[model samples]
Target chain A: MRGAILHAPGDVRFETRDDPEIIDNTDAIIRMSATCVCGSDLWDYRGINPVSEPAPIGHEYVGVVEAVGSEVTTIRPGQFVIGSFFASDGTCPHCQAGYQTSCQHREFVGAGGAQAEALRVPLADGTLVATPEIPSDELLPSLLAASDVLGTGWYAAVAAGVQPGSTVAVVGDGAVGLLGVLAAKQLGAERIIAMSRHEPRQRLAREFGASDIVTERGDEGVARIMDLTRGVGADAVLECVGTPESMQQALRSTRPGGGVGIVGVPHGVSIDGEQLFYSHVRVQGGPAPVRRFLPELVELILNGEINPGKVFDLDLPLSEVAEGYAAMDERRAIKTLLRP
Target chain B: MRGAILHAPGDVRFETRDDPEIIDNTDAIIRMSATCVCGSDLWDYRGINPVSEPAPIGHEYVGVVEAVGSEVTTIRPGQFVIGSFFASDGTCPHCQAGYQTSCQHREFVGAGGAQAEALRVPLADGTLVATPEIPSDELLPSLLAASDVLGTGWYAAVAAGVQPGSTVAVVGDGAVGLLGVLAAKQLGAERIIAMSRHEPRQRLAREFGASDIVTERGDEGVARIMDLTRGVGADAVLECVGTPESMQQALRSTRPGGGVGIVGVPHGVSIDGEQLFYSHVRVQGGPAPVRRFLPELVELILNGEINPGKVFDLDLPLSEVAEGYAAMDERRAIKTLLRP
Candidate 1:
């Protein structure tokens, strides 16, 4: 089987590798039907995050289970399924409380390499949620999104405490940010503010139910949000970019008693204690327990209540994974879907 | 009027100042019956927080209203009252959302200085909560505690989402931290874990409903908390310390989905974004909106449901203000009360 591996910075190669096998009694082998490039992946491709050694990459996938370990009872072979980036034993206390990312027994699926012809997923019974059936190619992109980005965006909205009649500010224009707009809309936000200078993304944000768009960045961005919010700031803010500026904006653009949910993979974000303490905003985020929202998101996607798959503007064959990475890194694509 | 004046670091002199009159239309003058030295006062005394010039130095007090401006209708002269360190209109959006400390027109009462014989309070209609009647000396300590420390502690518990059957961990054992334990108990926390090494403070914490006292510092403290919670951490954590280590400990001590409320005046606290992003802990706090809880807290104190005033271990005359500061700085007293 062939899988994507990073030999070094700016290098992604799809080469032959031994097929994965079920290792743990609760593990299963999944043949990938679809995978994609995540925003975090650009970190390594751009040399911002150093790749110490050649390793398997990518963590999002929607596929068919090929084989399952004897101990896997809920999931079986030949079933179509979606898997979260982190494999969780759903029975753990944290998982029971809807924080699967912090599950007592958890594994990063990327370590097993999901961007391959086949992948090994641990904790199969609790990690993989079987779909109604093998989805059509048209439904594949949206289903695959539920594996990470869509569910992540959903988690961000939920974490920020978005509810009916709430006002939300989204601070990023990536796929996750767009999906966050969709999620906020689905969650019944009365006003959704998308902070974006890019015209294309701005259009998509409006289509996703954004009531307002601000082209400012930094202090100007916060000012625009304050202006639009009658100087009270948004009721909730979704921080989909994890830079220092984004974090600060998220904190500052929220009403004193509001909430900020950060889903971006933070690289160098450092928050001043005095600022956070005085801001009076509730801040919460993490790896995003995507599995916790997968079932509901899957149902929503199947019912056509949302079209998060619209984020994937570019599609490429598995052999063109390098171009997919480059396209996203260079802003040529919001998201790139890969067919295996 | 004689007030505590910080002429310079290590130089606190009792000096005379002009008697304050209602300057703002919303202002009121109060005759101080009692005030206290706060932990943060020592910062300027130790030169950590510079005292640029001679400045009045105290923020917490309970007293009798002496005079009021024409605009002050809700409160009148001769009413015994408890006031928060910060004055808020209580009609602002932030105040309406229960975060009065971040009120748009909020005023720090210390600027008018409560350590004097008579003090001027701004936003009188919203800042001063009248007592049922003149509080006895016994109730004075508790009501004065409500002016800041107890109110701050109560905010910490509320922000940490303390509820019935919840297990809470409190970091810091100063007057505020010990009071936090009391607040958690009042909020019905089932098991309260207090991290403190001071024997006297520890005793007060236990008396305030700390079920367990872990006399460990830093990692050891986190380990103790984890060991007690079966390695999952407490359901809620109260961070009463403003240092970086305390912030990290608070983040680490809470369960993945738990909440942390930090009220310490964060001087040099800087939080690592990646650390907080991956931690998945909900963090909320600030200079507590003491007025938001003042009325309810006063009712509880008057009804003898709780006794947070016990945190004040040393009482001194207004002339002994310097000694009061020294006693807390040398760790000789948990809190110091001054009668003017």
Candidate 2:
């Protein structure tokens, strides 16, 4: 099997690798149907995040289960499944409380483009949510989206406490941010301001139900949001970018008694507590409990309520996986989907 | 009129001052019946917070309305009133949203202590919530407690999202923290943990419905809380101390999907966003919206649902107010109530 591997910072290669096999009683193996390069993948590839050694890369995948171990009761071979970046047992105390990202038996699905030709999944019954049937070919990209980005955006909106008639602001215009616009809309937010400078992504944001778009960055962006809401700020702010500036912008865009749901993968960020205290804005965000929202997002996509597959700007064969990474790293793509 | 003034750090003195008179159409002149020294007052008194000049001090008060301006219709002359430290125009957006402390036209009553024999209150009709009639002599202490400490604790518990059958933790052992234990119990939290070391406070916490007491501080305290909850941590944590250690401990003690309500006046504190992100804890705290909870707290006290007055350990005449500050600053008293 061929997969993408990160040898070091700036060194991503497509290479042949041994096929994965079911190892544990609760494990299952899947033949990858489709995979994608994540915005987070750029962290290691661009060397912003130091890659200590050659490491397995991808965590998002929509694939066909090919084999299952003895204890795997829910998922069976030949079923279509969508898996999240974080694999959760789905029945732990945390999972039961609907925080699967923080599940007691949680594990990161970081294997060298495990979403390539074949992949091994642990905690199979809990981590994988199978669709009713093998999804039609036309529904593949959207189903693949439920694996991470859409589920993550849904979590961000829910964490931000977006409600009917809420005025929401989304920071960052990546796939996650765009989908956050959709999520907030679906959650009944009356107004959504998407902060984006990119033309293509902003178009998708508008299509995703953003009522307005502010091209300003950082403080100016926050000022725009405040202005839009009559200087009171938005009721909910979705922070999808994990930078200090983005975090500050998100916090500033929310009114007192509002909330900021931060879904960004924070690297190293410090928040001034005094400012937060004075802002009176609630903060709640973490790794998206993707598994918690996977079922609903799958339904939304399957039922045609949201078409998040529009985020895919570049698509290619699994053999040209290197190009997919390059297009995203060089800012030519919003998201790159790889057909394996 | 006579009032208490902070001439310098550790230098509180009684001084003669001009009598307060109605300053606006909505203002009222109050003859103070009682005022109390707060834990926050010690911050500036100890020189930890900067003070440029001899500042008029004290914010908590229970008084009889001596005079009412034309616009003060709800409160009239001779009515006993319990007012929050911050006087808010109850009709403002923030006040209507239950964050009266951040009201657009907020007046800090303690900027110059209501501890004075006579004081002017702004927005009297809104700031002062009146009893049906002047309370009996025995209810004075308890009603005075509702002016700030008890109301603030109720705000913290509400902000923490403590629910019936939930396990809650109080992160400070001061008057507010002790009252928070009572509020949590009243709010129907199944288990209340008070983080305290002082014998007197521990006893008060127990009496106020604290089911467990963790004497450790910082990380050790968090560990103890986790141990008490069988390693799942508390469902809600009330942060009544604004210091970094207490704030972090409060954050750490909450479960992954729990809430932390912070009421302590934040000084100089910074939190690592990554740690907060990974923890998946919701953070909501700021100046207590005491005015919003004042009505309910008054009912609770009136009905004997709680007895927050027990937190007052020292009582002094208004003339000996300096002694009240000394008692609290030296940690010899949990709270000091001064009768004017």
Which whole-number lDDT from 0 to 100 does residue A211 have in model 1?
Answer: 95
lDDT for each residue of candidate 2 in A1-340, tens digit (9 for 90 to 100) = 8888888877778887888877788888898989998988889899998889887788889899999999999999999999888878888889988898898988787653564788888889999999999988888889888888998898899999999999999999999999999999999999999999999988999999999999998777877887899878898999999999999999988988999999998877889988999888999999999988888889999999889898998989877877888898888999999887
Best by lDDT: 1
User: Once all C-alphas are superposed, what RMSD does model 2 give against the true structure?
Assistant: 1.2
CA lDDT, every prediction?
0.91, 0.89
Regions more than 4 Å wrong, model 1: none
DockQ of each: 0.84, 0.77
TM-score for the second chain in candidate 1?
A: 0.98
Poorest lDDT segment (10 consecutive residues) of candidate 2 chain A: A107-116
lDDT of candidate 1 over B112-188, digit per residue (tens): 77778989999999899997688888889999999999999999999999999999999999999999999999999
Q: For candidate 2, list the clashing residue pairs, or say none.
A: A56-A112, B59-B110
Query: Model 2: which docking level applies?
Result: medium
